[model samples]
Target: MIVFQQRYPVAFTIAACLVCGSAVAQSAIEHHVWQDKRKFEPYSRTAKSITGAIRLSGNPDFATPGSKMTMTFGNGKKVGLTSVGASWRQWDETDDKKATAEAFKLSRDPGHLRNGNTLCGDPQSDPAQYVVFLERSTFGDSTRLLGMAVFGSKEVPHDINSQSLCGTFSYSTD
Candidate 1:
């Protein structure tokens, strides 16, 4: 197991491998976000805002083809770009920053549907592009699946669940 703590961002990341008997079977990533209310203390432990875990296991023989699973919180909120019907290359990867930038531009092309501040695009017509832009502005550098939270609050974050997509994409509040 490996653990890394970042001070400024108040993030704690844990990477570990699971072993059954003598052989390792799976690896997991656990991330925790903390909100500090201390002024003098730099490393003050505070209330935890979120906790996320990603685990991968099983063999190809037992794995289902074309199967995909998106992460969701205990509050019934979906996490990561996949939740918004976007791919890793289109949103988080450093190698595909160009594609990510292009998607941000096209999202505000004036033809896309708008729900409050978010921009909704057609995932079919624009493959690799963001199907749902949470906000009208450009995507942030720090914004990624690991660092993002959706529906984290008791109040509805946005109307994306109610707004119609390009008909190819669908979202649910439940």
Candidate 2:
């Protein structure tokens, strides 16, 4: 007959193995978004006011996290060739989470290229930064986002930041 001196160790080992197995079995799916193209006539008075609409889609695998995910812009066409004043917000699924900061700038050159950085609060409430790239397609009348990549930390602070892409943005000059 086999005798067991301690059952607690055996039970703990079994529980640990089950937890680790469940974690290994669960794989995270990549999320994505594509904004519908729209036309924007350059604002005329040093900064012309333009208006347009865009369709935002979430990747099939992930759910749209919230209703308030959006982007906003401030003053533009400043300092000869820079759009200096721009601010955007990316909302999360919960109100307890603060919106991600979308601070970006655009080149005044003919291409009107865009480059910027965004920061989001992590689960630990630390700020994580991401690089953004945007450009207007010369072949088409629409604008395209080249890409955005987040780095510097293994763990993303915000849940929305974990998605392949957080939000699709549409803009107008006002």
Best by lDDT: 2
lDDT tens string, model 2, 59-138?
13222222112222222212111111212233332223343222222121111212332223231333333222222122
Highest TM-score against the true fold, candidate: 2
Candidate 1 vs. true structure, TM-score? 0.18
For each candidate, the alpha-carbon lDDT, in order, equals: 0.23, 0.29
What TM-score does each of the candidates earn? 0.18, 0.22
Looking at candidate 2, what is the lDDT of residue 63? Answer: 27
**Candidate 1 on 41-130: residue-level lDDT in tens?**
111011022221222121122112232333322233332222222222332222324222111112112221222211223324432222
Q: How far is each candidate from the true structure, as Cα RMSD in Å? A: 18.8, 16.1
